[model samples]
Target: MDDSTVDRLAAELYQVSQTGKPVAHLTKRYPDITIDDAYAIQLAGRKLREADGRKGVGAKIGLTSVVMQQLFNVYEPDYGYIMDDMVVMENEPVKMSEHFVPRVEAEIAFLLKKPLEGPGISVADVLRATEGIMPCLEIIDTRYEAGTMKVEDSIADIASIGKVVLGGALTSAKEIDLRYTGLVFEKNGEIISTAAGAAVLGHPAASVAWLANKLASYGVSLRKGDLIISGSLIAACSVEAGDAVRATFDRLGSVSARFK
Candidate 1:
């Protein structure tokens, strides 16, 4: 596709997201589309964001759970850049008006102390690149019309990530085996979900590793202090006005958010 074709597709996808329209048949509608070309559309959306002065500060890895992959029929995980504007404090109550459409997820976030770039980075490499990790909640909000979305459409729409909330004490990656770390999610004081670190692509660090090398193909890289939302540890929970949600981790700590 030409540059104009890429931009048109990008704008259409962003509008589809913002309008909450079902974009399932976009490929059929736009015959020039391929996952690679769809990604070109995705980048065009980010370029629009950059044109608006937003700067990417981190990355989010999705499809870490085999269950989610099985449900989606995708063998590989998808990723999206997290701009600085998306990061928020967990202690603060999240205003409902801040989002168009949203859902919350429990995750362990890492702030790298060194750059992570890869064509062949390993889980061990991710652990070594660690500065510290913390508990977090990522808000995945979609703007697709009809509210239905495909994985590629979501990836093109910044993985449907709207905001991320981080808190709890930070711990060194060496302090604990993230694979064995456990967490239980609660909403209004009731346990709603449970997960172990191993659930995320077998280990949370591997998600970051996968992201590093994935972005390397485009010449993008992760830097020190980049806030990576490793992947959801618990099944995502629906949020509505006045609902309170929290996730307590086995070692990392706890983070929470309240709608409205």
Candidate 2:
């Protein structure tokens, strides 16, 4: 709620991230914390990461689907900045030891070629920005005790973002009907879920549009070359050492990660 309190919580999160130890839920202790205060804590965490030499790549959207929203008891999506250091090479094995507790989700990533800012940004505007989309896997590692986080706690914890793995060839946004694009999510060589891009807020582009408009309210804009990860098409799956996860898209090829 206050600047000092926000910084303290952010520092606690930053410390846990480094030590791979989760802290207690923030909201359970600070019940009166507003969404604005949560975002302020997120911003403070961003500044702390930047100070540590991590550059902001773009942002990731979460809870984009009505199902996820209802599960979280929220009507809108939440977001967090994506840092360059959060990306892992497509062929690399993710070291689980570096994270507190991570779960993976499949997503479509939008690579913007033009700036998009708004209070009224639309899916059409997002597509017209002219770039492409790629298959991606987002690793959401919450820095809080398991099953103890509330929506505000998640917001302050950088929306539970951990690392990201991107693969697949980039395809022009105009060339594909994202709503019809489908994905087969797999874990340890078995199919886990099957979903379409429509699972992410009707169309993946719509998620990006929502992100752009939401960012505008915080005095942020989607810049050229920013890679926006639309929310997951499938539910988050817990991953452990020796496990493998992959998402194969209908036209976007596939991306995989092995945990070790």
Clashing pairs in 1: 17-143, 17-144, 20-143, 20-144, 20-145, 20-146, 21-144, 21-145, 22-145
What C-alpha lDDT values do all the predictions have? 0.82, 0.91
- For all predicted structures, in order, the TM-scores are 0.91, 0.97
Off by over 4 Å in 2: none
What total of clashing residue pairs does each candidate reach? 9, 0
lDDT of 1 by residue, 154-231 (tens): 666677788899976888889799999999999988999998999999899989998998889989788988989899
Q: List, residue by residue over 174-240, the lDDT tens digit for candidate 2.
A: 8789999989999999999999999999999999999889988989899998989999999899999
